[model samples]
Target: MASKKHNDHYTDYFGITDKKVPFEDLDVHNDTRLFLDPHLVRLRTSPRPYWDQAVKCLDTFLETLTVRVLSRNEDPGDLLKHIQEPPETHLGMARHGYRGHAASDVIAQRIWESLTTDLYSLFRVGLLEHIEDLPLFVRGIDRDITSDITTRVFFDSLAQFTMSCMRQIPELSSRGTIQIEKTVWDPSHKQWAQRTYTVPKNNDGSGIILIPRGWVRKRLLGSASRFLQTETLTYIQHSRAQYDHRGKLVTPSKKTLRKELAKEPHQANIFYTEAAKRNRQNLIAQFWQYVDERYTEKGPNLGDGLARP
Candidate 1:
């Protein structure tokens, strides 16, 4: 009786009531042919709602991951502690220099390590949670299927689908060696440091390194001693002007003029202007360093032209 019912289900699925109607004789090209098999028609239409639910589930999962994993604030000092000391002074207080923070080498290593660890943790947790919640998100599917088995099947199907999509883009499908450059802040000298890695397409995921923008900025600013020096000088000169020499203001001394030119407002303005210019130059140099590291291919020389806008 069980065998008879199973055979009947197969017959209904193929839309063949009479065994005498050979499967090869059916007109496969006919538009009406697809509707003949109720199972085929249902399979084609059912995936839309399931896919919609899956996307919603993915969005919710990402939101949770961003809040819980990516946005967790860690102490700068603690993160810096993992940095390894470098052999020589590579960073400093000048333009494109690493400001003298705790130490450049140590800070750079720490930033790399902390970000990589955080990203790995995020990926692991996010994937696991998404798979675990699949049953809840995907509806009107086989309820008897185990979550573990379903998750595997879903991922396998997704991987196959992704590969098929990627085939349309030749650039993505091509296999080649790629170089990845990473910019790290060196604290000992206030500057950016770059490291490059060559990764083969086969071993691509193993070479992935994640660095947070906030972490990089924090290190860059932390090592920025040159800015501090300029600010200090400006503050000192301004403060000196506030003090009166007895009742009347004292004449500009040679030492004062040479050091800061604080006595004359015109000279003071010039000094501030020069300092501001230097700071801007330094920032521009830093920006160029990043540009060079990321976009290695030679192109038009924009140079100081970019400073205009």
Candidate 2:
């Protein structure tokens, strides 16, 4: 006789009884497609309630990895050895002032100057957390190509790689990458400036995918929400006029201050959004360093670890 198995409506297991329901019992809606994958959903509607906290988490993670690498006594002596040798023929133009002004020396100097300016521009706005780029620049001055490659590999390998790997671990599976872009709001400019990026994505083989204005706005809004929640210290400024106050005890309306404070969140949002974009570029720079370093030693470990978590 075949074993008898009753198709009961409910199964008695754990604390609750499982009620048998038809497969079609669940309701399907248009929104279902949007939330199919959590990462896709978060990417689409980032800056969720926990985004501020998430950014803090991300910042801490980055800092920890950076400290770990910097603290280590193990030096990548290979990069130094490589720096001793002249670059290949491909770098001749780069060495001989092909991409700058005046003589090759002037061009090189200008190139370095411009690069430093751009870097400082990013740093002033808080995109850069540390000043390690200066050391990297000094190391790579003579052999620009090799030096650039070396530094790039180091950053990427250290942070991006770890982030990529951590995401795979069971506890962090739900976490996704944070991305940022930039947009200029000045009305007078003939051509507007804008940029988009995917955090964590660029570390992998895939680069930051630039999206449209609509998407950029969404990203900013989300990131702003995150920033306000995390950075407890409020950012503010005060200005006083000399000549105007001499006339009398003239007090500007408290209403104006209130209005400005109210608007601060919006302004802060824009500032941080732009900040995130600059940071993205720095992160990308570090990623390239990781790539260069890996190839220099191992010749090419093109496995899964290349993409940062």
* Residue range 36-81, candidate 2, lDDT tens digits: 1111122333323233332333344324323433443243222222
Off by over 4 Å in 2: 1-103, 125-299, 303-309
Residues forming the 10-long window of minimal summed lDDT in candidate 2? 26-35
Off by over 4 Å in 1: 1-78, 81-173, 176-226, 242-309
How many clashing pairs in candidate 1? 16
**Candidate 1, residue 300: CA error in Å?**
14
Tell me the whole-model lDDT of each prediction, alpha carbons only. Answer: 0.28, 0.28
lDDT of 1 by residue, 1-309 (tens): 011122222123334445332112211111111101111111223233433333343344334433444555443332233232120111112222111123344443443343334233433334223322222212211112211122222222222232332343233234443454434333233233454544322212222111111111101111112222333343434445544656764443434534544333323432343344444433223333433433243222212222111
TM-score of 2: 0.19
